[model samples]
Target: MNLKKTLAVTATAIGLGMSIITPAHASTGEENQESPDACMKSQSASVFKYAIYFNSNYGGAYRNVGYPVYDFADERVGGSPQAGTQPLLFCHGGSGNNQGIKNNAASVRNKHSTYYAVTYYNSGYKGSSDWATPNSSRNLSQAYNQNASFNWSSL
Candidate 1:
């Protein structure tokens, strides 16, 4: 083939290959590149519905968001009690401090659409624990009342 014709054929082939490949990947609905947290946020508008109310039965100070709240010292929503008096506190893998909501949470609420949160009595997810289901709110029982750390899992 002439130089112009050969170049045109090559370009057309490349274009067609890209078009076919692109659609194949797009149609699979598996091109997700978001992090797990981001994915959870997108899957449920209620993901951000999570909050820890200070008072019982979803009352008092509250923290509402998809991300785990490790500390309540900075949160003063609705004149929330001091860290130690706050109704709730969340902790991840690391061991949380003894003071503050570590052992003073009065209530817990999980508004996630597909995940359940596990609260522990001691920091670092050690000691006793209680699992809070999604879209649910309840007062911390006497045993798990003073929770320290917590983590969540998909349902």
Candidate 2:
């Protein structure tokens, strides 16, 4: 073939090859949403009621392998409990719930081997003791200071 014709054919072949090539992308479009279930058994039965009790009575529960929980950050104090060390958790009662908390305190304390007490205030609205007041600065300040005084953040 003549030089021009050979060059033209080579150029056409190169253009076709370049058109077929694809630029690399970071990820594929498809992804698996769930993995195969492991041979894990459910222990949710005990975890649910106990966790609820802890939250209602003790602010929160200690972490366990099979349970999930949450609590107000302002209510808990963390400290190392040595062999003979006595730890305490105070539950401030809301409204006329003093009797309820008082009755449960011993059982909770026994379960944890730690002192549990209930704080009762003047008769007021339901839910939280501090909710009756319009301004929460006093409440927040008290909560922050109390938690800070005991260094609850460390726990």
Candidate 3:
């Protein structure tokens, strides 16, 4: 084939490949914003959901087991507590500090029935306990444990 034809064919193939990879709704003229149908979709629409359990102390009198599950299937509408969704937990990225996931109490609570942010500090770091203290970590951990006990389907 001539150079012009070869280049045209390659460009056409690349365009076709990208279109195939893009979602159907997105491939259409839809803007980046999510539609109300997408927004209302619940956690039940998620492909992954599960919980995590841990013990404060293993095999000892002081040991206390806790469950911390992350269920993606709780499809409560975001920012609507009246939707009867499970309490949402927001954990800040990379160290999970207050600044990482900082939000006003009311703002966080508005996401669901209950909302919590988890903060954790690096172990053995010599610094004031005021920032990301162990107590806060434990408290958030316990909250996750309690929330994990629910059957989100009923909510």
Candidate 4:
């Protein structure tokens, strides 16, 4: 092929390859680059959902879980997408300190700019639920201490 054609073909191939390799969040057009947080690469978000608290009114034993979890029992915390996660833990002072987050959260703050933070009462996002709008917070009514799963929703 001619020089111009060769360059064009190579560029096209690289672009196509990038689509597969780029993290999902980076490809969403929200930002041009992947987050620096290691665990963010696989599912890809610049930040964690929000503060899920062990007390009502958004107090005590809070964690910034960086991704939606099927169950808090899944001992994993924010880290490299390639590196395995350690158990999720409270970062500071609180009544529930030293305890795991599974079925323990009572209130939450939603920090995502694009999605509502939804917490469920059963595993796999089933059963009763409560939600906090982006940048908002509220104590769970139905789920309460029974919380089991979590996910984000655009609606």
Off by over 4 Å in 4: 1-46, 75-87
What local distance difference test score does each model get? 0.45, 0.20, 0.22, 0.61
Q: What CA RMSD would you report for each candidate?
A: 17.9, 26.7, 18.5, 11.0
For candidate 3, the TM-score is 0.16
Model 3 stretches astray by more than 4 angstroms:
1-19, 22-25, 28-34, 46-155
**Order by lDDT, highest first:** 4, 1, 3, 2
Which 10-residue span in candidate 1 carries the lowest summed lDDT?
Answer: 24-33
Q: Write the per-residue lDDT of candidate 4 for residues 90-149, one digit (tens) a residue.
A: 545659886777678899878777778888998766789998888898999988998877
By lDDT, the better pick of 1 and 3 is 1
The residue pairs in collision within model 3 are 42-75, 43-73, 43-74, 43-75, 51-69, 52-68
Residue range with the least summed lDDT across 10 consecutive positions in model 2 = 25-34
Clashes of 2: 2
Over the full model, what C-alpha lDDT does candidate 2 score relative to the true structure?
Answer: 0.20
Best by lDDT: 4
TM-score attained by model 1: 0.46
List model 3 lDDT by residue over 1-155, tens digit each: 45675565457535634211112111111111122222222323422121111223111011011111122222233323344433233222222222111111111011122222221121111111111222222322323222322111101
Give the 10-residue window scoring lowest on summed lDDT in candidate 4. 25-34
TM, every model: 0.46, 0.14, 0.16, 0.63
Give the alpha carbon lDDT tens digit for every residue of 47-128 in model 2: 2111111233323222111110012221112222235422222222332221221112211111111211111121111122
User: Top TM-score: which candidate number?
Assistant: 4
